[model samples]
Target: MKSKITVMLVDDHAVVRAGHRMLLSQYENISVVAETARGEEAYQRYIEIHPGIVVMDINLPGMGGLASIRRIHGRDPYARILAFSVHDEPLYVTRALEAGAKGYVTKSSAPEILVEAIIRLAQGDTFVDPEIAQRMVVQTVTGTDPSSLLATLSAREFDIFRLLVNGRTTREIAEELCLGYKTVANYATQIKSKLNVRTTAEMTCLAYQYGVLNG
Candidate 1:
């Protein structure tokens, strides 16, 4: 008999992980080998398990999922990663793909979609949520880049920027990201300059306009 495809799940919420585990358990050919609640643990877990694929949530507690994907790919360039996000913004999709994720799926998508994505990714194929794919096509056709400023952000900068716009104070962001307050302050300055925004309110407005923040 063929070996089942092994998977590692990374998400901050235990409930979410449990739900996915239960859902995937029904599939005889797919086996969840390990689970982690923090993005920082993902790389180490991947190193240990070397699963067939990693299903990662983008909004993790520490380091975040995008950074985790990059770190895992840094260790194993051929690592298969399927980014799972609550945000359906094209920017999230583009960033996940850029960070070396093989597929992208949203939490709002049907459970079957997640299973299908994992199957395809495990087979070395790229999978994108159909709705996100449609939006990506529309975005390309329009040629208007609402997320242009956002795209300019580096992974760390983007993480800080998101926290800033979400009303996280500089000290709060520093603590959350495990950065020195001065370092986070410096990133904040750079983010504001890069985005040409003056205040957190402006940044929040931009985030909302670009679909970076959900209502």
Candidate 2:
């Protein structure tokens, strides 16, 4: 008998998690082994349960989904994570991939697409929503995508950049990420230097122009 593929669901919404569990349960070969509403707890759960695949939402309550993916991948290089986010921008997909998620799917994707993504990741294949993949291709070919502008930032820097552009104060970012205020401030300065913006207002403008600000 084939062993069922185990999955961990990480999202901040109880109803969304329930919906995902119900949808994934229809597949006899798949089972949800664990679920959580916070990225910090999700990593701890992954360490404890070690599910076959992780379906994570990028906009998590604590630690953020990108950080969680990075932490898990750092612990287990073979870890397979499918980044499920509401943002359809190619930049979000790129950031998730850079953070070590094996696949990216938007919330707008069909239920079957999510199922297919989970199965494919479990089978050692990567998957991205077809629409997102096509958009990425188009952006790459056109050379107009702002993703290239921000690609130089590391995963941590990218996370900080996102927070800074969204009007988050240094202390707020530190509290959210559980980092020291000084460390977060340093990251903020570095992010501004990398993006070539001197002021938070300019950073916000750049983010808005590049479509990096979450809608």
Candidate 3:
């Protein structure tokens, strides 16, 4: 008999989870055994559920998904996690890979790619969305990038940066991304340091100068 691959879904939006659940329902080998809307919840549940694969979104309610990934990896180094997000930049892609994620699939990709990613990761193979990979690799391998310095950000830090550039306050970023206020603040600091900015206003100015807002 074929063993079923236990999958967990972690994302803040309820509708996205519902849609993902429905999409996975059509696959025979993949079973979404658990789901959570926050990174902290997913981490706690991951210890209990021991799913074969965890599909995680970078932006979550309590802890950012990357932090949850680190926690889960600390407990079980061999844990198979697939970073699932809308972020298509090198910062996110490189960070997910650095954190031991076996796969990276963008939300904009076809639903079929999600299942394909799960299957590939469950088999202990690495997979990255083709379109995202292209976008991510170019900037890193290129020289003298004056853009948003996105190549320097990790997955979680990039998540915080996105919210900040999109007109979200630190408090609002904390609430939207499901992180503690202090944690969000720290991420903001790290982002500024990476981009060499001293203030949020400077960060925003650089964000525009780098064309990330247009991105």
Candidate 1 C-alpha lDDT tens digits along 128-157: 999989988988999875786788999888
Which stretches of candidate 2 lie above 4 Å from their native place? none
RMSD of each: 1.7, 1.5, 3.6
lDDT of 3 at 146: 51
Q: For model 1, where is the 10-residue window of minimal lDDT?
A: 206-215
In model 3, where is the ten-residue run with the lowest total lDDT?
206-215
Using lDDT as the yardstick, the better of models 2 and 3 is 2
Q: Tens digit of lDDT per residue, candidate 3, span 75-188?
A: 898999999877665556667777778889888989988998899888889899988777656755875445446767876776677668867899987876667999999899
lDDT for each residue of candidate 2 in 1-215, tens digit (9 for 90 to 100):
99999999999999999999999999999999999998888888999999999999998865888999999999998999999998888988888888899999989999999999999998999999999899899888988776677888888888888888877889998999889999999988888898898998998998888777862
Q: After superposition, how far is residue 195 of candidate 2 from its true place, in Å?
A: 1.9
Q: What is the TM-score of each candidate against the true structure?
A: 0.93, 0.94, 0.80
Q: After superposition, how far is residue 7 of candidate 1 from its true place, in Å?
A: 0.8
